[model samples]
Target chain A: MLKELDPLLHSQLRLGVMSILMSVESAEFTFLKEKTNSTAGNLSVQLDKLSEAGYITIEKSFNGKKPLTTCRINRKGMKAFEDYVNALKDYIKK
Target chain B: MESENKNLSPEQSLDLIASMIRQTQGNVSSGSFYFLLWGWVITLCNFGMYILAKFYSPSNAAFIWTLTIPAWIITMIYASRQDKTRSITTHLDKISMWLWIALGITILPSWIFGSVIDWRVNALVLMPVGMATFVSGIIIRFKPLLFGGITFWIAGTLCFIVSPLDQYLIGGVAMIFGYLLPGYMLRSKK
Candidate 1:
């Protein structure tokens, strides 16, 4: 069955972010920024969309009082990605 | 009721993911400084003492090890604390970590099963580490690690060929070439 797909996650930038995060245990915002080649404002907006859809989670804290932002992939997101890939595979298989 | 804590920002979603990953790993950023510093010291000293002892009698080697066990035991009590605070903080770090650990596991047993500690055991350890790295490199395709793993595998085989006699200098050289140097390369890397 095709699971409910997230439109936010469906976008290129957000999709790329999730793809990378899916492979990694977690990553920092700056790392993701460099990776996706997305500007700060745009990446921030895209991440907000994914976060809204329950696909990924964001964290903020201080490392010796300097703020650090970290992101991780969640289980629901993993399942979704696995299903998405499987669904995508169906298209590819034809 | 949809109460005060409303929608999360993109950052918050990222944070949730981070927390979940940490939960799976069960690593807490609660390491003690003294212990980490001591681990650095212990490993370094062990490397040094073991090398120097090869020239002398087995008894002499025993003397060189006088403090290592105590230090290792003591430091391990607080080792987990140090593990968490570092980054390479992503899951990629975890892969690197297990690669390093598997190297230790394979080498440590052979090192312990010592009549003379064949250097070839290092070669055996290299097989998995190399394959993992090479495979991962192709998939994620990082270059240096792939190269490094292959290099270590080749060098490890050489170590075994000339072993025991080669134990002292070659072991030192392989680790320097195989691990320490590569580790530095990875650390200073972008």
Candidate 2:
């Protein structure tokens, strides 16, 4: 009776983003891009997927003249992340 | 990293989480700047007041504290700039910011009602500062800051027994230990 790993969180980039979001209150798009070492386009796509799943919230605003995007994990995302980790633990234990 | 959709095994997933967390936690420079800035400002002001009170005029010595007004303005401007430039805000960062703000809120009232409160303002100020520093040390996991916080508390407690003039000198020394030393250590760590 082991828990199943979360499909949404099983991917590399999304998991990386979620992991970063778990430790921080919020992070800019550039920060996620840099930390994940992914292209802006790939990071943007993964971020949108996370947002669509309601795992995280993305806010688009202007920092001076430039467009600024910030991402934060919500309660659902936190629960999902915790569950994913527990599931990983279960798999490893077996 | 470019393989955005690459599926991870359980072990890889766990490793990724741990690594990302380490990366996120690695950026912790925001607190050091403020610690250094306040350390210098408060230490100088304390020593300035001691010098003035000891030699020039006890009556006008309190005027030197007004330097903090300019320091406060600079802090505000610097915070705004930092907010604009910083890409990430960690929970530890927010917690430390609010902790200091809560302590700061208490300080203004203590000064305004100094005559009525009748406690040595040094102790009143240092107690909260010590608490903030201690908690900040725990949050950042920095040993020097923990020692700094202890020094502040000890100096604050001594203020209860010492003369008004000597309190200034003790407080100045405490600032050197509590803020400046740890601040420099934290800066160097970065």
Candidate 3:
């Protein structure tokens, strides 16, 4: 039986963001922006979507005078990512 | 890499994940400070003690070790500051941190019981130091540190064959190769 890929994770930017978050404890908004090579507006929108889905958490604070945003993948996110990869493998095996 | 927001095929998705993970691995190389600091301190102290013992006075040789107190303080301060400021922390970084902390604890008994162990303390310290270095190298995926760790173990073994005074010389040289050399290389990589 073929498994369905999570629609939320199928897009390029969100997948890239999630991939980077998976590798680290948490990442700054700038770090994600640089790694994904995404514009601020686009990255912010995708991050909000992930946050709304409860796959990840976003922390907004200040690093001195500048606004700092950090993102972390939660347990749900981890499970989802793992499931996504498994589904990916299933597709590849075909 | 712009946010095209386009959906990817399974193959493209897999490729993206692999490349992103590879990019994060480079962050592990930022640990050069501790290695370089300890390398210079230990090496200089070893050489200083050797010179003092051989030339001026064996009694004065032990005084050189006091420098480690300041080294300990600086390491603590640096680690605290780094923790507050670092934007990212990988599992590898956490594992490497705990490994060194455990190794440091293992080495403490040797220092406290230096009189009981005598000058063999150098060899004892080297073993755990080697373990930490070797493991750290593997965690960071750096080859020089892996070799450096082996160098420490070899130096430690050689210390047993030499006179107490000569052990200092070996320890000093070992730090140069095991710690300083790889440390500089890591810094350059960063």
Candidate 4:
């Protein structure tokens, strides 16, 4: 029996974001965009979906005059990511 | 990356996870500046004091180590600048920073109190330094730093039987193994 893949994390961009966030304590919006190689508008949308699903938290503040956005994976997100990886492993074994 | 509708196979998902984790791990490049800076500073101070002790009065020789105060101030400035530019903060980074900060706090008091009590404290100071480095290595899973930490502990133990001046020499050699060598290796790895 194979575990079901996480709907929230099955897409390319969303999974990429989760993967990056899972490894670090926190990352800036720009950092995520760069790592994912996604446009700002596209990355922002994916981040919003992840944030809405409670898989991550987005903090918006100011660094001097410019707005700073940082994202961190929450407990739910970590568990979901771990489960997703385990599920992927089960699929790969078959 | 803009194709949001594409579904990945399990193999692709695993590959993505591995790649992202590698990318995040690669961001740990800023540590070399600190290691190199402090390594050179302390190494120079130790050797400088050793050389000065031969020709200068003891009081003058003691003043050489005070260079660390300015070096520390500069480190603070450099660290803040680096921090401002960093886009990611990992758990390991925070733990490593706090461990070194803890070392600084303990070392300062030990140095001052040792001087006041007329006891050589290089050996005493190295013990905590070893602990900090060892634990940091464990956090980062870096073997060189783990070995470097052990080297400091060994040097500190050997210091107990040596003269105060020789302790400076030992400390310098220890820093070479513990900080400079590992520091350079980390830089190259980056």
Residue A10 shift from truth in candidate 3, angstroms: 3.2
Which has the higher DockQ value, candidate number 2 or candidate number 4? 2
The lDDT per prediction is 0.55, 0.89, 0.88, 0.86
| lDDT of each residue in B6-40, candidate 1, tens digit only | 34444444444444334324221222233234334
Better of 1 and 2 by DockQ: 2
The per-residue C-alpha lDDT of model 1 at residue B187 equals 46
What TM-score goes with each of the models?
0.50, 0.87, 0.81, 0.78
Off-target runs (Cα >4 Å) in candidate 4 are A1-6, A60-68, A86-94, B8-12, B51-55, B59-61, B131-151, B181-190
Root-mean-square deviation per candidate: 9.6, 2.5, 3.2, 3.7
- lDDT, candidate 3, B70-182, per-residue tens: 99999999997776577777877788889988988998888778768664688998978998999888888899999999999999999889999999999999999999999
For model 4 chain A, the run of ten residues with the poorest summed lDDT: A59-68
Name the runs in model 2 displaced over 4 angstroms. A1-5, A90-94
Q: In model 1, where do residues sit more than 4 Å from their true spots?
A: A1-5, A34-49, A82-94, B1-58, B63-93, B108-166, B173-190
DockQ of each two-chain model: 0.09, 0.82, 0.65, 0.71
Worst 10 residues of 2 chain A by lDDT: A59-68
Q: Which tens-of-lDDT digit does each residue in B157-185 have in candidate 2?
A: 99999998899999999999999999999
lDDT of 1 by residue, A4-92 (tens): 33455545566667777786777777767776667878878777877887889998877666676788888888888677655554544
Candidate 2 chain B weakest lDDT stretch, 10 residues? B111-120
Error of 4 at A60 (Å): 4.1
| Chain B, per-candidate TM-score | 0.50, 0.87, 0.86, 0.83
